[model samples]
Target: MAQECRIPHTVLCPARTPTCQTSPYLEAIRRQLAVRTRRLNDTGALTPGPPTASGQSDDPDTHDGPARPVVQLLLCRYLAEHAVEHLRCVAQTRHRHRCPHPIRALTGPAGTWRLLPTGPRRGQLALPDVLMAIYDLGHLPYRGQLRWRAQRCPQHDAAPGAADLALAEWQPFDPLLHAAHIRTRLPHPEARRPGSR
Candidate 1:
């Protein structure tokens, strides 16, 4: 028989707990860790959200375009506290026979990187001081701020690969490049080429 899950009022996720994919507690925390990327997208702080095509490069570094106004918010202590709160709630709902949701106990030293934020912006920095302050706390584990750059993704020719299979690599969505590719491939554009005209 399995032992009863006697979770505490607060689930103590230690610093050493493995990442979300490996640790059950961290996994639960991951589910709750919504970075609010959509909010950033809506404000034009980022080019756009995901759902990239398989053949197209998703790497932000490959894009060669004017930079957009962007900001990054590093969640430090806030992340840990949030995880604790979430675990506490899950613990409260644990079953008598066994926890319906198993929370792997935190062990070892704390990890440095719980979460890292990265995205592009459309224009100048316009965040209010109060809101920035919350993210800029001294005690926080991670640090970030709005930064400007010309190209979100550096342009590069993709190496030939299995055309039918998606590459096993991270890619940044470059809407500009995607649109340009589509524009070039259109049959109407080919018919109006300089030689034909």
Candidate 2:
């Protein structure tokens, strides 16, 4: 019998999901694009079009099937929504639990991942500016597992110390390090002050 997954959060988070297998169509496109990119590099040519697709599509949105990035974005949105629906709110504890506001995807520059206002009111600010997952683990040359971080849930801003004190308890995932943890680890004035006693 399969072991019951006691912690659904670990298996369900976008970071824990299995790496996507490349589809044959996309692989073919990738190879074609690679060759074209190399050819263009050799000839030093510049044009305004999808640099990644060789006539496969003038626009990635009109392709035969949704591209990998598009699919990944949809998956991220689904997971974010699911987390807000099923998982406990970041502010929840054994004694106190507060329902979380819905999670919303924000758009910004390339590789931007932000969770902002959850309500459905598209305006100049509500639209997504980028396409990426909320989390990304980078492999730096010397750094073991450190990487850039994404925006936190806006609700955390209300509590005076919630941002700092509630970090370790924010999410169930072990590898998902919060910004507060980083700040806490750095030297603080209180720690360096000389004892007056």
Candidate 3:
């Protein structure tokens, strides 16, 4: 039987879940974005866009925008839906076996987002920056570039001969050939009231 999805607002079974095999990593990214969005909003660092027809402010957390958090979330979703295999360690052991470890940091959000000091005076303010800028950067890398950079896990990263043992054949990823998972739309804010199913 397929596994149950624990992701909020999602109802798909494992077979139909796009991130079923990689939900942990994707969830971490999502949580980071949500937290950052909240922080920025609270601090007034991010200006709310014009109100929608329903008079609700456009929430950066759920809407696509030029903001860093939204862009990062979108990038992560694209990666999760298309190049998920790249999210795993690609290093080859001396025995010609692929590393079993995942490429994502095991320490969750803190491991991905680190505190960084940045301001006009260089010490006036501290902000969180993505550890590797992989998912946080606004620009997406060229095709296969991320996979090449994330080829090894922390343990096998510097292992001698690891690169030499890499598999020779590599298949290109084609999103069209894969089954796309259905994305659950977030309900209207009013529908989230108590006793509202």
For candidate 1, give the lDDT of residue 2: 90
Cα deviation at 160, candidate 1, in Å, is 48
Q: 82-101, model 2: which lDDT tens digit per residue?
A: 32112223444234555353
What candidate 1 gets wrong by more than 4 Å, as runs, is 1-21, 48-197
lDDT of 2 at 139: 20
In model 3, residue pairs whose N, Cα or C atoms come closer than 3 Å (at least 3 residues apart or on different chains), thus clashing, are none
Off by over 4 Å in 2: 1-34, 37-89, 93-95, 102-152, 161-197
lDDT value for model 1: 0.24
Residue 96, candidate 3: C-alpha displacement in angstroms = 0.9
Q: Per-residue lDDT of 1-197 in model 3, one digit per residue for the tens?
A: 99885654332322134443555777566567677776655443555556799975554333222112111322332223222223457677667777776544343221112121111222333433322111232232432334334444556655545663444222322223311221112222332223222
The C-alpha lDDT values of all candidates are: 0.24, 0.28, 0.37
Best of the two (1, 2) by TM-score: 2
TM-score of each: 0.15, 0.20, 0.27
